[model samples]
Target: MAETVAARLLARLREWGVEQVFGYPGDGINGIVAAFEEADDEPRFIQSRHEEMAAFEAVGYAKFSGRPGVCVATSGPGAIHLLNGLYDAKLDHVPVVAIVGQTARAAMGGHYQQEVDLQALFKDVASEYLAEVNVPEQLPNAVDRAFRTALARRAPTALIIPADVQELDYSAPEHVFRQVPSGPPDAPSSVVVPAEDQLARAAAVVNAGSRVAILIGQGARGAADEVMQVAETTGAGVAKALLGKDVLSDDLPYVTGSIGLLGTRASYELMRDCDTLLIVGSSFPYTQFLPDFGQARAVQIDLDGRMAGMRYPTEVNLVGDAGATLRALIPLLRPVTDRSWRGRVEESVADWWSTVERQAMVDASPVNPMRIVHELSLRIPDDAIVTADSGSSTNWYARLLRMRGGMRGSLSGTLATMGAGVPYAIGAKFACPDRPVVALVGDGAMQMNGLAELMTVTRYQDRWTDRRLVVCVFHNNDLNQVTWELRALGGAPKFEESQTLPDIDYAAAARGFGVDGVNVSSPDELGDAWDHALTADGPVLLDVRCDPEVPPIPPHATFEQVKETTEALLKGDPNAWRILVQGVKAKAQEFVPGRR
Candidate 1:
């Protein structure tokens, strides 16, 4: 009896403890697909409607499990379709391994059907690690390298296997197949201890500063205790990047919410006033939100040495694990007893949150989007996993939803792509079946890919015991974010017809797909709808009629932005009047003593 390359590779995946691989099947991958069907191991193949969704599911799985996500696709078009989702993983630095099928090796360069230079196609996205298994003997090594590279680098990797190679008989001895030991795979972990000199220099920078503030990212998620200890010793306020939403409790008095365009007033003030910035495990790209090197002395700590001081210049670049570096530097710093600066900043945070609460409670005609999201934030279980789309929904989720009580979250981080929310919820549910999963998406994004992806939720709805997948669709019938951006920022007068969408009955569609469905057109109906979705026996799609008139105002507005809004309002744009009113109210609050 002889084992095929596909069999051996599948065996290796089992040895590496891969329980499943998300993918779609096609003719080009018939050999590998056949092998997958024959395998009696844990790495079962889960079929998806589209190759893109498969890749997004893989990225979502990695986010939930904190392990390398695996996905497979057929040749040419199948592989090409994966770029968007692969880019999602790449830009966000999530570990994903994409296995793509190729045309037979012998038929290369002869205009063969479904043939492509996969390595070249994936070079930019998977440039960190991309390879093809040209022969049977190379299969094991390619598998090992791809998985290892993805985990170590925290990026997507590609393995292109030609159809002929997948079918080739394994001529190596039986011992060769057993080279990879059968045990749990090595989990992703890092503990980069900086040199003593680097630690001392970083400590000296922190010790010298009177007003310190900390900026955290997803990299510091596991070091929450260390982050707080450093904050306590130095009397610093913490501003989180969107990815670091749960790095610390939202209720913490000194922990400011997210920074950047989606930031709070407290975070903006913290960045504006700090004399020294302590950056930990964050490669936050929006430099304008951070104080310039001239404005503040900085100390940066990152596990990857290359990322140290990449976003902002620093007095000391400590290349080490965030936890380890913070622990080492905490002892050398003196505790700040004068709590005056922190007290003022805390008051600002309180005032800002009160304003947010007022905005969320605003009684409007077409239901305010914030009201739905705020209600969701209050109604969702503590252990819920929320995945938000990239649009108006993201604006509400980022600003309103507070991550606490062991709730987890995932979104298209760096790429900031749409169509990831529903698939992400499905994948998150797959990875952690015991927890509740929710997808927050706008009408535009839901119509883009999420509606079709709901069938995927229907397909796997009964596979797990705890089926708490909820798709909360904001049916506003417009690409509200783009409309506002074009009007307010691009100097356009009104939203073009191209940016608007037809009203969709998403709840009806979900019911058509054999899933539970609810429709709410007003705020009064919201609570019961949420209750129905949360208590449903299977996946539920809640379609809430949302107001497209609400503007996604930033924490701080510039003069130019105000000018544009006034121009749009004078031009009699549909939503500009409400926006102008909101802007005026915000400006008035700014002038009010102790209100900002």
Candidate 2:
């Protein structure tokens, strides 16, 4: 049998050491599907419930595995469906390669079915690299470059393969003129370090500050030890961006939790008080949460020169790999003799955690949503991979949960997209099949797509060596995040038609999909439910009914924000009284005598 373009593409993927491709089936890629069958599922095709889920799963796999994830889809709508997840990857700086089938070459411009111009559709999302494989000869270079560009730029790339071209006999590019040939699939590795002068300047700035603050993002994952060494030398308080939450353990007394609107008071205070700032591998955009401009002498270390020095007015911008650059810069840094700043930061961190505990335990109607994650934080295994969807659940996940040991966590950090929690967990499971995975999701997002992804979990559970995937749904029956945003930001009451969600028994849905399902209405049941789900032989779903009135107030709520909330409540919020009560109770935790 003659090798086809589809077969050749799969072979290239195998050569690149790709273990899996997350995608859904469609007639546009009928040739590739047949080739997959013929290849005996080498570089296995992991089918997702939807194209968007496939892209998100790829993003998750890439995020956890430190490799470029690949997702495939059919023409037109399937390709379109991949945009949101691809955008998530692009915004979060995750490397992903999307291979989508396009309309048959002959039918492309005739206004035939699914004949959308994919190049235009994918232009912005895959701006790093986008190509159409018009012939078998274009296959190698196109696919290889897509992978290479994705990794090099740390962004999404795309390849559009025409349906008819996928069936053509494979042909390698000749070594003659006008033919573009590609070498074997191999990623060149190198250590990037900033120039000696730049490192010295960065060190000088760090050594000069009395109260130093260090901010880290996903880019600092590999340089944890180096970062800690720098922190100790400078007596700096460390603050993590949401994407970099797992970079440093929260147990570190000087490590302030996430820094932003959904941040810890310790982190907010850390930024507000620092005389100098060192941003490592994070382009955390909320400049308002950072030290006031011109108040602190700042230094930034980033691998991408393009992204460095854009977020803040840094005195020195060291363009290098975080681990290598920090290692080089360490020798030039002078140790701080006074430890008062470090002591203050540590004290604040401890007090913040105490306040978090008090808030999580605050009373609610049925259950406080914070307790769901707070309980999980207590029981989650040291090696668990936790994922959270975007919602009010994110607030608890950000503040309540502590990342320690080998635990890894991620979500749609930059894009802040819903419906990513379950798929990201599914991808994490595949990326590290031996590790336990947990997904914290909201009721709105669960209904949007999570309920369907459960089937995908039940289908693949046996493949995992440690099948302890738990999806905990915050069943608050409201678009809780947006509801709060409407009140706090827009100064508008929660419009029932827009904010309310239809109640669904998520646990029942899980059971129907052949997974264990537990329903918890009382706060007392959260702990036992988590224990059972965490130790289950297969995947489990905890449908936890929680209070929607519980507000996810910012750590440092401004007077204007409080005023807007009052205005919104006065303007006829449905649960105005309960909301006020919950907000007061939750916020009061910060001022409690010993807790503060």
Candidate 3:
């Protein structure tokens, strides 16, 4: 018999290029952790107080490194916790591999301690799942599949090995592992280019149109320069979704900016005013914000076939990679050097930015959410990484914050999960301690996962600088923003307007946990608090009270929008009916209007 099963797995993991990971140890996983300890070339292991953090740290590592990040945990709660982070990875298109230790095979159904069905718990959340019932022979294949599926779809996958398997010794040659395949080219070579006439038709749409807007999603990052060239030649501008913000700089003359709530005013105005909107490489949601017949004609060019016609109707839905499709289409355009159309749209964008100076400005209000974000944005080192909690803070950051060339913003912007910001902030600081990291949270979300990290941060602060983690809480009392939106969506209002939260000092709660605490009741105190945290010797907490009535992520609904959208949809009023039809026409004339 060989010495131990966990030792062999550890050896193989080192061979698979794993360097650092996070997890918590337990009784069943003793052999596994011991095996980890016994290994000569041991990977660096960071301890997580909760299994959830263990999984999320892997998510952060994968996002920052663009590689598969690994996490480990014991059975029961450990294996069950792979859901949230795994789901986060899948939806965000990140690759993560979770190695969960299961209870002994014999003890599985006998009400054994820490025994649970990890396979069933993770089935829906994972892209691929493998259970190692036997050791040695099957282990390599299972590990390979976990990595392959995780990377293959750019999502999270799992490998669950029983504790008994980790203890059983099976001798085998160590050279059995094979390389993870680089994967096939996304689109097949058989996907032939459009015929010359089809290319000419798209080109005519490009050349004949005076004002064309190119909308890039996450699918457009690689072909950014080429898209810029097309816009340069064809009197067109660019509009990107929030995920596509990195495709071009916010300052680019041809690039009008992003088009969603996190977008710039100029980009939305451009998309709303163009003759034609050319969507490239994005499956962005929020169809309501897109240009319709009255605004602009939309011609989408996307790689994923499923995304076509999912949102706005397409005038000419071109199916191909953004770069490849643009390469094919540029040749067909009858080179027209007219600058009037492109120049005018850029002018409109400039005009929009001029009027939007109300954003991110410091005000004399006792507590201003925008001012707090603005001050942090200004004082925090330009390299600082920020994560926005899904609350008023999220809304505020989406409007007021800017990401420089090298800066990264972490949030589950797609799925919009509430508690991710705090955990992601902790994980980011753990990975990149040098960059100033601030986790901005609304009180509702901070309390969800905030306590889990107090121990970890306190213990690590002695060794690592306490300044790395600055937890800022917006103590607005109630779930004011969400309840407000619920009311906007036809739900009941949250009591009267003159309401607030119960009295309990959150800064005091943080102080009790051995973290730095600063209570900010006035805007005068915000800059000093943030500055203190930035310069402090450990992790700090800043609890600032932002009035609940401050405007949300997007400005509060205009009277026109409220009457046009709400009354028409909710009220039985005849006047509301006309606005509803008009709203539909405003959003859907591109696809098919006046017909549901």
In terms of lDDT, the best-performing candidate is 2
- TM-score of each model, paired residue for residue: 0.95, 0.99, 0.80
Write the residue-wise lDDT of candidate 2 on 503-524 in tens digits. 7788998999988999999999
Of the candidates numbered 1 and 2, which has the greater lDDT value?
A: 2
Candidates sorted by TM-score, descending order? Answer: 2, 1, 3
Model 1, residue 268: displacement in angstroms? 0.5
Q: Per lDDT, what order, best first?
A: 2, 1, 3
Between prediction 2 and prediction 3, the one with superior lDDT is 2
Report the error of model 3 at residue 162, Å: 1.0
Worst 10 residues of 1 by lDDT: 178-187
lDDT of 3 by residue, 1-596 (tens): 46776776776667667776678887767778877777753776678777877777787667655567888888788777767777777777777888888888888788888878676788777746655545555666566667767776667888787888888885553543642222221212333344566566677777767777788876676687778778777778887676665566545666665577556556666766677777887877877567765566666777656678677776677777678788888877665467876777777555543333343342423476767776776677656677776776776565455555556666765767777766677667656767667888887776677656766777666544435678888887766566546445543434434333455677888888888889999887888998999888788889897765454433224465364436433644323344344334323322332221
Model 3 / residue 193 / CA error / Å: 10
Off by over 4 Å in 3: 1-3, 109-113, 173-208, 221-231, 253-258, 261-265, 293-305, 315-356, 359-365, 461-467, 495-504, 511-514, 531-538, 553-596
lDDT of 1 at 295: 90
RMSD of each: 2.5, 0.8, 7.5
Clashes of 1: 0
